[model samples]
Target: MPSGYLDLAELEQRADYVKTFEGVHIPGLLQTEDQIRAIFAASVPKLSEGELEVRVRFRLRRQEILGGVPYEAVIHEAALRIRAADSKVARGQVLQILERSEHPQVTVRVVPFAVDGFAGIGDPLTYAGGPVPQLDTVLMDTPHGGAFLDAEAQLARYREVFSKVEEAALEVIESRQFIERVVRSA
Candidate 1:
């Protein structure tokens, strides 16, 4: 439980009721080990080799929830195509997306770049389901750190944003095709 974000831990504990909205990068629960490693290496260049390995392992372990629970993600196309690592790494990442899209418990949708006035233009956010709908929280990513939103007003705003983003995104099947097309071109 190394994740600094409380919402992440809550999501892991109650993954069956989670719905995620990812506008920047692939959601953590869907990332492969290599992709996680590459991302950490780039983001924290000073991390020692051992530390990098530990972090990558932790990330992969966190992703294990995908095997047992239900979740949904709406990823922006810009996040998918951005080469955070080398070409081969990018290809592997795309392939991971293709594989995960097949899972019955997961819904992977892509918001194409052509969608005008997308709601996710600012940053990526995640909404975690609670025992009661009113208790759910919205997690927002920031350059300095992550922020959790549980206030009714903030949750309402983020929910609206996520709804609009999902509307602009392709359906799961079409998203898989779009991802495959991008992977081939990559």
Candidate 2:
């Protein structure tokens, strides 16, 4: 869980743009209600039914940012094929990416499995903008929890990581087509 001052909510309020990369799971801000519920249902320890509902509600609420923020998500093809729930939910997840990719504020790109020399194997990351370059922050997910990095050296490394990962991703139109194929075969 995130703290109050530096949580995703507060960070989003301060940033104008956010770029993310997801490997094994869908990024939170881009997830739909049904997909989020499915993710929560698969919690490792197994969240209680009530806990699952609460997390799902919180996740769905965060997705509202997609309508206004200039957000870009580069997702791995493996994440798309990994089923979080039944076929219905997996199909919905594929279509969700396709539908949201069409939004003016949201850009969804894919890092196909065939890409060579891919570098983003660590974890999901959100690189957020700040009023000045010096104030930028990088948020990386971990099994323990979320880790925030702001030192100049750390920021620079993540910046390079994001750039290389983004470059390996398909272009907007190609990404949409790739996801559309997944949807059709789902």
Candidate 3:
């Protein structure tokens, strides 16, 4: 498969070979149906009702990696707390994360809000597999669209930042508990 907008699709096809890092909100690969609908509705408000459903289904299709693949995510506490579209939607999102984290192929960690001056403080990113074992790319989310970075230097920097962010984040079990607490509060 060609790379670009279909990067997520490619990742799903080659699920065993992908590793991802998400700084804001849960990664699409881990989002629930309700959470995905809310995100698409807000992000693409111009879509007609029918188009919205199509897009949400497409987004949910990306979650196949959670079933049988090696994937990991490092999410920030602030991102988890922000209501994607509304409090109800956000609550459901947290529950989804809690459920998905139990899978053997998935690892979800939370970077606490108290972490001082983290590398991924301002932006959320996606890292995808490349053609080679040591090759990979970084995709940064933008207001206009996603920007893909394939240069080795840029990918290296982002990888280092992700490593640091993970170091500053809660352990997998702790992160799950935090998400459960948030869901219960909602």
Candidate 4:
């Protein structure tokens, strides 16, 4: 509750579809436990071991929504390249992404560095599609908390932004291959 996890989790649970874009780090739902642990270990104020484990469990629990609904993640190449923990952990994390991409309800796309006319290197965003167009919400996470937008205009803008970002990414199959290359290099 203090982390606003409950609010975001509830929204994801009620949504029919979820799409996320990440430029700096892997999306939480797709992260491995080790990866999540590494991320929490870097918290500014620092968390105790108990607190870190609790957060990790909460994050892992949130991934259950992916099994019930379609989830699409369009991640930038930079996120794939960055080492969240160590080489072993980073490689393991990408491998997990590759494995998850094969799921029927999961789609993973890559935006390579060679792509031209691309400018979506800003903060990450998650667009959750509600049952009706009027119910859709766009979520952007900040250090302070989650920001939810449901106004027609704001939703339309984010939808367009997500469309453009998805267009810039490689196809699912190509993304798998690209990730394989990254794994091999690691």
Candidate 5:
């Protein structure tokens, strides 16, 4: 959800729980300003400096939900290891993830390289709950752009996909430890 999307505001306000997955990039809500700037700078067509600032601000603003909502972020080890900017930025990100994991509302897990049967490589998703289970929406990332899936079958399949990936992830405590080791090597 970006700054001016009324729909994003409304949905987030009414949601009971939010779940996210990141395989390549950091999940949008958990990304920091420096990381966001680095990503925008690396974009193919390249966003104007003004647009980049706007996006970074929007992303940081959306992060406030980490304290308000029950959010679960399942990230992969590969995403954790890649230094989008540099070691300082990566270390800050890992520390941020560790700090936020202490919040009662946020749950962060990492799927390490040793994990098996985890084939959700191309899927990046945020499953936002609604007033009722039937109203939930699955937001997915594709090569082209973002996609929203709301049909029953689609929802069921995505739910299963998320479940399996989450199953392969390290426990919260272990995940933090795994990230700490990464920082040590960095």
Candidate 6:
């Protein structure tokens, strides 16, 4: 994994539960191959073909953690509508998310544009719960790279943020229907 992803991957591996709040992009755990490739292809410095493939592989591998632990995602509607790749890739991404949402341990919720109260925090964040509460960690992306927050106060703040985001999201069934509507439009 790259430096930006090392700590996140390690935390995912050690976590027994995970919750993510994404306001702009699809959670990495739910993104498809094309989506991941498109994201890397649009990087600031521009990754070479080999570098892109390596990073894609690392992310795909990290997704394997989803099957081993409970996972919940509160995704903003913008992520579902964005064409990070082409229309085909965007449609496929939504389809994959819908399929994954069927998993017993996987929960997907969406916060639609119609939601009046939630404007979203700043960036997307992943809250990984370790075996013990004190071991919990929060990961958020920064312009520099991924930032890890494990301090008690930081964890507490992120927990509240996650709770608010989750509260604003639609129920699981509604989210699946919302995604289906997006796919139909695609």
lDDT of 5 by residue, 61-144 (tens): 878877788999999888888889999998888777788888999999999989888764557888888667778988887777
Which is the winner by lDDT between candidate 1 and candidate 2? 2
Best by lDDT: 4
State the RMSD for candidate 2. 1.8
Cα lDDT tens digits for candidate 1, 56-105: 87777777777676778888888788877778878888898889878888
List residue ranges in candidate 2 displaced over 4 A.
1-6
True lDDT of residue 178, candidate 2:
95
lDDT for position 117 in model 6: 83
Model 6 scores what on Cα lDDT?
A: 0.90
Query: How far out, in Å, is residue 168 in model 2?
Result: 0.5
Model 4 stretches astray by more than 4 angstroms: none
- How many clashing pairs does model 4 include? 0
Clashes of each: 0, 0, 0, 0, 0, 0
Candidate 3 lDDT score relative to the true structure:
0.74
Least lDDT summed over 10 consecutive residues: which range in candidate 3? 1-10
Winner by lDDT between candidate 5 and candidate 1: 5
TM-score of each: 0.90, 0.93, 0.86, 0.96, 0.92, 0.96
Q: What TM-score quantifies how close candidate 1 is to the native fold?
A: 0.90
Task: Note the residue pairs that clash in candidate 5.
Answer: none
Deviation of model 1 at 21, angstroms: 2.7
Model 3 over residues 1-186: C-alpha lDDT tens digits? Answer: 114547657655763455565666778887878877777777544677887787787777777656766777888777788777778778878887888888887888888777776753457777766467356767788777778787888988888877777788889888888888878877
Candidate 3, superposed: residue stretches over 4 Å from native:
1-4, 130-134
All candidates in order of lDDT, best leading: 4, 6, 2, 5, 1, 3
Q: Candidate 6, after superposition: displacement of residue 135 in Å? A: 1.3
